[model samples]
Target: MSDWEEDWDNGDSKATSKPYNKRNNAKDNSISNRSDESGRHRSSENRAPIRYPQAGEKRSNGQRHKHSEKIEVPSDLVGMLIGRGGANIQRIQNDYNVRVDLDKESGTATINGNTEQNVKDAYNDIEHHLNNGPGSRYNSKDGSSGHQSNAIYNFQLKGRNNKPGDTDDIEMDPSGVIDWEALNKKAKKERAARWSKLPELRKDFYNEDPEVANLTPREVARLREENNNITVSRVFQQENVSENIPNPVWKFEQCFSAYPDLLEEIYKQDFRKPSPIQSQAWPILLKGEDMIGIAQTGTGKTLAFLLPAMIHTEYQLTPRSQRKGPNVLVLAPTRELALQIEKEVNKYSFRGMKAVCVYGGGNRREQISVVKGGVEIIICTPGRLNDLIEAEVIDVTSITYLILDEADRMLDMGFEPQIRKVLLDIRPDRQTVMTSATWPPGVRRLAQSYMSNPIQVCVGSLDLAATHTVKQVIEIMDDGDKFYKIREFVRNMGKDDKAIVFCGKKTRADDLSSDLTLEGYMCACIHGSREQSDREQAIADITSGHIKLLIATDVASRGLDIEDITHVINFDFPRNIEEYVHRVGRTGRAGRSGTSISFITREDWGVAKELISILEEADQEVPIDLRNMAERFKSMKDRRANESSKFNDRDGNSGSRGYRGGGGAGGRGRRDRY
Candidate 1:
């Protein structure tokens, strides 16, 4: 692991497992298999008797339990056949009241149950999953998965051409393998049996929130000012939720009941007090109410929801080992953010809790191994998470706490569909907390669609705004003048200063990093085109102060935290104002002062109006030339709006209008985070 990955560690949490080995992870970055049906990872310890049959367990007559013939599971298919953390196998055992175990060396499985029918059903279930491995892409009738060929049991591929350079060894065969309807019936039975054990929803856990009554409008106004313009209102209705709101926690001791581990994390991280968002969010969230936290970038949003999740997951009635799947699911927009959240989760020593970060570019097998090791929280990006869901590596149905960090960014990255798909499987009553810097229409639509009576806690104005601590400096110049302007700023840099330069394109970032290096200025660069590990290294280099300068595109704009970063230089302004806010907000983090320099050329005039608005909102100096450019763009926009019918963009994402429109690329307002 790079130092960047471990930089935040204070060794406060009892880490459940070590990071996955990277030796063979190169080949397996994504799960090739996907299906709507999924199962959960579980351990044998403390599992209900309905799941695993004990040794010598038999019918009332005291006869020996019937054992199914050993199934020869291919060595490679064992993981899926048994499911990650033995979830699939455990599902089968619970459904049929059977005992199933895998022999890794022998590559075989045995199923023992009270009746022959139970053993046979369990065997068929494993066979079905084994059959539906990555190689089998096509489904049979009713969109149901097909089983593998009988020859695969012996590690032999049937109908192999053995042609040179042919890598595909497994093939799909949909020919009737088992009674699909009968298996469905067994699955339904198992689901019902398991859900019956779910603990009742309760807000009055040992750790309690300050139960306060309704606040007068005047009191609310006063409270908002005190909490940095934070506003809390119920958005929907839930049976268990209270109309009476809870007061925000000013101190860590006031929020948690008796969690010493969490306090230890707070102390280790040197968090003197809760940020505005955390202060209010912690109270509402700890009260078990769905919440939407709107806060500025780098205002301690991660810990706001994370700390509450620790309390909820650990204090639940079910033990971590006995749970069917993860208790919490945090949907992040990017892998960097996902890994960052995982790091935050790792910093606390809270009840031996574990969390895993799964994304598209990381090793799928290694992720599966870590998840199997047992994790209560699974923090992941949408795409890879959906893939894992399809492969049954994760089961969201058991998840009770759900968080959508940067809900706007997730939708902007075109992850709405995936987010919705993931949400469909999760329980409706799960405590959901969504945090976004701005309250956009799309985010509102999503919250309305899924969340229970959510208490929306807005830390600042809901409008799109940059970090107020950063001093914004805008220079309107020719495109060619940008290079020299950035050079002058870099030359005047303080030794302790760290800066992140933003470019519009990946190639531009690479070129900038190279030209600067040749000019005797060493720097790291990152964008979407680089390998996952390489991108991580670049971030690590800058984060660990191994390098004082870094260049990147919009990829680094969201959910990246380097508190000491002194400057943000917009070498090439982003296409949209939303991205520009994210870029400049990268600096001036964690209550620190910073500076942002943007060289805005005529070509970048489209976003000028919105740029001026952001600058004015942050009380930063806006150059006269920049103001003139915004007016010019506004006139140009009015002219274009009147010129042609085709000029009317449905989302108006061409420039400053994009911010007002509050959408992306005529799709999910998502262009690309990378």
Candidate 2:
């Protein structure tokens, strides 16, 4: 039997079973503000946008209050302060019967009530809740704690101090703007301190937890190369099971019974066993429940959601007479992932359901025609979808099943506007599913707002990082030496093994590809800078095995799904550890063994050390020297933070001055590597 772990909510996939609702009663207080997060807040709305209000706006009351007297808060948090649909705010007003006026623009609040005690108590409660609560935090990692972060030791209200004769807290004027320079300086000091503590925080990854770290590099590589005792079955198995596990198989069998022919077609394709994500997700999605799938790449996530999407579409599929509606709409962060999804959907959507891939960069006219012709399943990136929506070329209301693949990346790439706009336009009764590699706080908030009691299915935690087929090696050297070593490695790779080289920038990818090609290594480069045609052609060449070596940025790092990828080379180390994982994940796919080598220069040691820590957490070996370099950076960063904090105490603005020793202005232009 294939090792399978089912998602809890999959047993009840019907959309009506779990209605999306807000937990908080107060509208303005709906968004929980964490104390440690400096003024950032989490909203209850399915979509949250950072809103900064202008000063001098009229208050809710007929009276206008001076702007400088009240504390300034981020606008997004204000909505939460008011109860659901403003009912909470009304209740507060009606209970105490206070004439409190909030001037959103100036961040000033005025209270006129029968009793000063009631008004003061209510206002203080609001302040206290925001300053210290699950919703508000000063230093919590997930921004869900009550304690103020260590970064703000002397944080104070904006209009706290006043001389008897000084006209400091005046009427709505340009004065009390929360001392932006001072706040920024304090934030910088705190961030530096937090980053410096990364080494200490890594204890969770290495503290005698076998699940966190198991094998050293030598043992893993030796075992992998020897093709020793370990078998695929041994590597993959369901360790923990209980009688309480839901009867999802029966539920799925019942829902999918009508489509015997489709089920036969699925099994005929030789996908005899469902992957972990697929096993759970397929049943739930087929039942039409909102879901949040947390699985890493290469865990068969595409098929997990696709199978159900296809099955659901087929069951409710309309004939060409009702072809104007879209049965399924899959939104991906990148064109590559979108296209990959379209391809997979097309394979399964064989019974009259048309699958279309729409994204920017290609010929829009042809794409427009494809969309207009009739497509049951549409896979697209937010940007192109928004363009088509704006042009009124496509109707999004007909979309029923919405899948946001790589959900975290969509948020990170700043697709909030487009995503919000699209979600607003879609039918409220649709089934939505979001999937991502990592679950951050922002992503969680998004899920809470958009998905209804989503079955949160996480295949493997950070402890079990990546699949075992990948061989990760980190080489530390000077910049020039690193490049030379890369050249040497490229020359030494087996001729039969295909390689993909990842760089941090388009220019670097192009430059390296040019240099490597001139040196007689067959290579093709792809990045955002290239035209749409060129990118597609480059990817086509790589997939066809026409190009043995492919160079790209993080663009091609996700969702390419080309089989037989033997090696992945990090010509330039990724800035973030998450990106590093995605880049390396391209190899060791389809049950094939692969090798990934990263060239870490002296300058990159800081980042490399974190990667090594992550690898160590995954039971991958880490070289000793790289660890030392990371420690050095941590120490340097700590000393700098301490010194900067002291300087800020004296000068009142250390952060804006920039890095420790360098003139603050000089550090702003450090993107010279590009």
Give the root-mean-square deviation of each candidate in angstroms.
14.5, 17.7
Model 1 lDDT tens row, 1-674: 21122211211011112233345211121223312123343332234322222234333535456566578887777766645444456446555666675666676777767777667766665665665564554334444434433223223322222221221333333453444345457556756776676666544443443443345557656866787878777866566866766766667887764777678778898878888888778878887878888888898999999988988988777666777788999998777788889988888888888889887667768999998788899998777777677667787888999999999988776668778888878876688889898888999999999987778888778788988888998887766667677777788889899999998777778877887888889899987667789989998999999999999878789878989999999987887888888888899998899999887766676677788889888888888887887777677656656644344455454433332322212433322222
Model 2 TM: 0.62
lDDT of 2 by residue, 1-674 (tens): 00000100211011111222345322332222212113333222342321222345443435432222244445656664553465434544544445445667666555555555656655654564355434454324443234332112224333222111222322211421134356677666765664453211100110122421354655544532343121111111225732111112312333345666666667666754555666455545655557777777877888777766766565553443654556678888776787788777666645777888887666668888988888778888776676676556678876767888998877777665667778877765668888888888778777776765566666656332555679998877545665577688778878688899888777788788888888998888877666667877888898898988898888887888887889888887886778888888899886778888888765665575568667886677888888887777677677777888888898887563344221121332344432
Clashing pairs in 1: 13-349, 131-148, 412-670, 664-669
lDDT of each: 0.71, 0.61
What TM-score would every model get versus the actual structure? Answer: 0.68, 0.62
Q: In model 2, where do residues sit more than 4 Å from their true spots?
A: 1-258, 317-320, 462-464, 649-674
Highest lDDT: give the candidate number: 1
